[model samples]
Target: MPVLLYVLAVAVFAQGTSEFVLAGLVPGISADLGVSLAEAGYLTSGFAVGMVVGAPLTAAVGRRLAPRWTLSACLAVFVLAHVSGALTDSFGVLLGTRFVAALANAGFLAVALSTATRVVPAGRRARALSVLLGGTTLALIAGVPAGALLGELWGWRSALWAIAGLSAAALVAVGRLTPPRTSTDHPGSARPRLDLRAELRTLRSPDLLRHLGLGALVNGATFCAFTYLAVTVTDGAGLVPSLVPLVLALFGLGAFAGVSVAGRLADTRGRLLLDVAGPALLAGWIAWAALADSPAAVWVLAPVQGALSFAVGSTLIARSMAAAQGAPTMGGAFSTVALNLGALLGPVLGGASLGTAGTAGPLIVSTALVAVAVGLRLVTARRRSGAPAR
Candidate 1:
C-alpha cells in the first residue's frame, strides 16, 4: 500500500473525531455556551445537514481538479472551519462553522475513497480502502472518548481546540504524501467530459438503486437507535451520569472491531450477505438492550449493538462503489449523503420514540427496519444473479 493512504487516513481520522466528539461534549458545550441542551444538540444536526448538502456539491465542483489537490483544499477548509468553531463566542457562529466543517469533511471523504482505490493495485484495492476508512472507526473508538475526558477536565472549547490542532497535522501530512495529479487522457490533454447526465444514468439500474436504497435504510435505522444511545443508557438504564462517556467510548471500541472484521469479510465473502446479516444481528442486539434493566446489561448490550451495526460500514460502502461501475466518486458521495441523512433523522426519531413509545419503541422500530433491509438485500441479490452475466 502507498504511504499516501496512511496520510489520507489521518485526515479522515481528524474529520471523524471532530464530527463525533460533539456527542460526548454536548452537555459541556451547553453549559459553557449558555444555551439549552436542546439547542446545543443542534450542533450535531448542523453537521449532518452540511454533509448532505456538501457531498454532491463538492463532487460536482471538484470534477475538474486533480484528486490530490481537491483533497488538500477540502482539508484546508476543514481546518479553517475547526478554528472558527474553536474561537467563536456566539452559538450561531459556532453552529455555522461546524456545518462548513462538515461540508469539507464529506467532500474529503468522498475524494479520498476514490483516490485510495485508484492508487492501489486492483487485487489489493478493497484492503487499501479498508485501511483508509478504518481511521474513522479508530477515531470513534479512541478520539471521541479522549475528547470527552478532556472536555470534562478542561472545557468543551479545549476539545474543539484539540481537534483543530489535529486537523492542522492532517493537512500537512496530506500535502506532503499525495502525488501530483496525473491525467487519465493523453499528456497535456483537455479535461475529459464530466458527463453529469452519464453519471445520473448509472443510478437508473434497478440493482444499483436497490443497493443504494438498502444503504440508506440500514444507515437510517442504525443512526436512529445510536443517536440517543447515550441518553438511553443514562436515563433508562439508570447508570451514573459520569459513566455515560465511558460507555460511549466502549461503544466506539466495539465499532472499531466491527469495522475491521466486516472489511475483511466483505472482501472475501461478498458484501451483500454481510450487509444484511450485520444489520439483522444489530437489530437483535438492540432488542436485547431494550429489554435489559440492569447497568451490566446496558454495558454489555451497547457494545454488542455497536459492534454489529458498525461492522457493516465497509461492506455497505464497497457495495455502493462496486455498483457505481466507474463513477466511484459520485457513488461515494451519494453514500456519504445517505449516511448524513441517517445521522440527521436518527436522533429525531429516537427522541420522538422515547416520548411516544418510551424507551423500547425506537429499538423495536430499528429491528423491524433492519429486517426489511435484509429482505430487500435478498431480493436484490437474487435479481442480480438471475440477470444475464455482465
Candidate 2:
C-alpha cells in the first residue's frame, strides 16, 4: 500500500530491462565487437551467472547494513555499471559490466523483497510482494521492447544509456524513500535482527528447500515453452512472423493479470490457488501440444498458459519467503537463485529435445517437468502427513 513499494518496483523495472534487453542487442553487439553471435549471447549468460552467485553472497555481506543503505548502494553500482557499459568499446569490458550490474541487481532485489514484507502487516505480505514483482512484468511488456526498439534505431549503446538513466533515477528514489534503520518492528521495541547461526539454519531448512525445488521445477516448465514460443507461433502454428510480437505481448498481459490476481489470494488462499493452478498448468501444456499447430489456438493459449505459469510461480516465491521467516533477505536471494536456475536450465533441456517433434516436443517436455513437480508435491505432502511430530 505504501508508495515506497512502488518506488522499489520502478528500480526493478530498470534492472529487469537490463536483464532482458541483451537478447535484442546480440546482433549489434556481435557486429560491433567483432565477436560471434554465440559469444555475444554469453553476455546474457554472464548476467544470469552473476545473479545466481551474487544474490546469496551480497545478502550475507550486507546483512549488517540497514536495508535502505544496502539497496541504495546496490542501485549505485547498477547505474555505474550501465554507464560504464555504454562507454566501453571492448567486448570484454562490456561483459564485465553486465556481470557487475547483475550482481547489483541481485542484491537490490533480495533486499527490496525482504523490505517489502517487513514494511507491511502480516496479512498483506503477498499483495505487497506482488507489487514489487509487477515491475518485472512491466519490464517484459514495455521496457524490454522499448530498449530493443532503441537498439534497432540508435544502436545498442543508446539502449544501455536509457537503462543507465532509468537506474540513476531509481537510485535517487530509493535513497530518498526507503525506511531508515531505526524504525521499530513494534511499538516501544527496537527493530528485530537475525541471529547469524539461526539464519544459516533457516537457510538450510528442509521446508525452504522444498519450496525452492517446487519453484525451480515449475519455472523450468513454464520457460521451456516460453523460450521456443516465437518459433512455435510462426513455424508450427503457421502465423506470420510479424504477429509474434502480438502473441508475446498477449503473454505479458496475461502474466500481469496472473500476478495481480494471485497476490490477492496467495496470502490466505495459497493452497487453493496452487491446488487449482497445478492441474490447470499440467493440462494447459498437454492441451497446447495437442493444438500447437493451430494459429487460432496459439492466439488464445499464449495468454492462458502465461497466466497459469506466473500464478503458480509467484505463489511459490511468496510461500518460499514465508518458509524462511527468520531470514527474509536470504530467502529472497534463494528465491531469485531458484527462478534463474530454472530460466537457465529449462531452455537447455527443451533445446536438446527440440528436433524430435517440432514445437510439440517442447510442450511435451514442459508437461513432463510440471508433472514431475506436481507429483513431487503430492509425495512431499504425504510424507509430512505421515511423520510423527515431536
Candidate 3:
C-alpha cells in the first residue's frame, strides 16, 4: 500500500473519533449543558443526519477541486468545528457544530476513498480502500474508550479539544505527505468539469442500488445489536457493568481484526470472502440469540458477529466503488450515505425490540436482517453465474 493512503487513514481516525466519542460523553454533556439525556442524544442523531446529507453534496462540490485539496479543506473545517464545539456554552451551538463537523468528515472520507482508488493499481483497490477505512475501526477500538476516560477525568469539552488537536496534526500530515492535486488529474489539465446531472445519472443503477441496500441492511443489523449491546451483556449475559466496556472493546477489536483480514482477502479472494462471511454473519447472530444466557458464549459471539459484519462491509464498499466506476466520488460518497442511513435506523429498531421483545429481540432482528443480506448475495451470485433466479 502507498504511504499516503495510511496518512489518509490518520485523517479518518481523527474524524471517526470525533464522530463516535460523543457516545461516551453524552452523560457529561447532559450534566454540563443542563439538558436531559434524551435531548442530548440528539447530538448523535444530528451527526448521522449530517453525514447522510453531506456525502453526496460534498462529493458534487469537491468534484471541482483536487482530491488532496478537498481532503485538506474538509480536515480544516473539521478542526475548526471541534474547536468551536469545545468552547460552546449552549447545547444548540454544540449541536450545530457537530453537524458542521460531520459534513467535513463526510467529505474527507469520500474524497479519501476516491483518491486511494486513483493512486493504487486496479487489483489492489479494495485493499487500499480497506486500509483507509481501517482507521475508523481502530477508532472504535481505541479512540472511543480513551475519549470516555478523558471525559470522565476532565469533562466532555476536553475530548473535543483533543480531537481538534489530533485533526490539526492530521491536516499537517495530509499537506506534507499527499501528492498535489494536479497529480490526481492528467499531467497538464484543468480540474475536470463536474457535470452534476451526469454524475447523478451514474448512481441510478438498479443493481448498484440493490448492493447499497444490502450494505444498509448489514449495517443496520450490526447496530441493532450494538445499540443496546451494553444492556444485553449486563442483563442477559449476566456480566457486571464494569465488564461492559471491555466487551464492547472486544467487538471493536473484532471489527479491526476482521477488516484487516478482509482487506487482504478483498484484494485476492473477494468473491470467496463474500460467500463465506454473509452466511457466517447469520450464523453468528443465531448463536448470539440462542446463547444469550451464557457469559462465555456471549463473549465469543460478540466478536464473531462484529468480525463477520465488518468483513461483509469491506467487500460491499469495494463492490460499490467498482459498480460506480464512471463516477468514483459519488460511489464512495454513497457508501457513507448507506452506512449512516443504517446507523439512524438501527437504533430505532433496536430500541423498539428491546422495549417489546426483551433483550434478545434485537439479536433476532439482527439475524433476520443479515439473512436478508445473505439471500440478496445469493441472488447476485446466481445472476452472475447465469443461473435462474430463485
Candidate 4:
C-alpha cells in the first residue's frame, strides 16, 4: 500500500468519528440542548440521510474535477461543518451542520475509494481498499470511545470541537499527500466526467442494481442489530450500564478483525469468503436472537457476530465496481449510498420489530435480511458455475 492510502484512512477516521460519536453523546446532547432523546437521535439519522443523498450527487458534480482537488475541497467543508456544529446553539443548527458535514464526508469517501483503486496494482486492489476502509473500523474502536470520554469530561460540544481539529489535520495531510491530476492513474483514459443522463443510464444496468441491493442487504443485516446494541445488551442480556462500553469495544475489535481477514481474502477468494461469511453472519444473528437473555452467551457471541457482519466490505465494493462497467466513481458512490440506505433502514425496521417482539426482535429481523442476501449470492454463484437457475 502507498503512504497516501494511510492518509486517506486518517481522513476517513475523522469523518467516521463525526458520523458515530453521536451514538454515545445522545444523552448529553439531549440534556444540553433541552431536546428529547428522540430529537437528539435525529442527528444520527440526519447524517445518514445526507450520506445517501450526497454520495451520488457529489460523485456527479465532482467528476469533472481532479480527485485531489475534489477530496481536499470536501475535507475543507467537513472541517467547517464540524466547527459550526461545535459552535451552534440550537438543536436545529446542530442537525443542519451534521447534514452538511455528511455531504462532505460522503464525497470524500467516494473519491478516496476510487482513487485508491487507481493508485494500486490491480492484484492488490482489495488490500488497498481495505486499508482505506479500515479507518471506519478503527474509528468505531478508538474515535467513538475517545469522543465519549471527551464528552464525559467536558461537554458534548467538546466532542465536535475535537472532530473539527481532527478534520483540519486530515485536510492538511490530504492537500500535501494526494496525487496530482496530471498523473491520472488510468493510462490513456479521459479525464473523469459524468452527466445526469450518464448516471441514469448506468443505473439502468441490472447487474449494478443487483450489486447495490446486495451491498444494502449486507449492511442492513449488520446495522439492524447494531443500531440498538446498547439497549439490547443492557435490557436483554442483563448487563449493567457500565458494561455497555466493554461490549461495544468487543464489537469494534471484532469488526477490525473482520476487515483484516477481508484484506487477505478479497482478491483471491472473493466468492468463497462471501460464501462462508454470509451464512456465518446468518448463524451468528440467529444465535444472538435465541440466546440474548443469557449474559454469558452474549459475551461469547457479540464479537463473533460483529466479525462476521463486516466480512463483506472490500469484496462487496469490488463486486459493485465490477458491475459499474465504465463509471467507477459512480460505482464507489453507489456503494456508500447503499450502505447509508441500509443504515437508515436498519434502525427503522429494528425499532418496529422491537416494539412487536421484544429485545430479540432485531436479531431475528437482521438474521432474515442476511439470509436473503446469502440466498442471492448462492443463486448468483450457481449461475456463474453453469448451474441452471432454479
User: TM-scores of all models?
Assistant: 0.90, 0.95, 0.94, 0.95
- Per-residue CA lDDT of model 4 for 1-390, tens digit only, reads 789899999989888888888988999999988999999999998899999899988977887777889999999999899888888789999999999999999999988888888887777777887888789988888999999999999999899999889888888888888877633345456764555567568878767777788889878877888778887899998899899888888887888888888887888887788777878788888888888788987788778887877777557877676666457667678788888898888878999998898988888889888888878867875776775321
- Candidate 4 is scored at a TM of 0.95
lDDT of each: 0.74, 0.86, 0.84, 0.83
- Report the C-alpha lDDT of model 3 over 1-390, residue by residue, as the tens digit: 889889899888878888888988999999999999999999998898998988888888878776778888999999999999999899999999989999999888887877888787788888888899899888888888888899999999999999999889989988887777544432354456546676568778866787688889999998889878888899988899999889888898889888888888887787788778888889899888888778998789878877888898878888777777666567778888888888888878888888787888889889888888889867776777785321
- Cα lDDT tens digits, model 1, 216-296, are 766777677676676667777788888876777787777777776776666566555474565566556566556745677
Q: Candidate 2: global Cα-lDDT?
A: 0.86
Please give the lDDT score at residue 170 for candidate 3.
86
Off by over 4 Å in 1: 182-194, 271-276, 279-283, 294-296, 382-390
lDDT of 2 by residue, 1-40 (tens): 9999999999999998899778889999999989999999
How do all the candidates rank in terms of lDDT, highest first?
Answer: 2, 3, 4, 1
Pick out the ten consecutive residues of candidate 1 with the lowest summed lDDT: 182-191
lDDT of 1: 0.74
Best by lDDT: 2
Candidate 4 Cα outliers beyond 4 Å, as residue runs: 182-196, 382-390
Global CA lDDT of candidate 3, please?
0.84
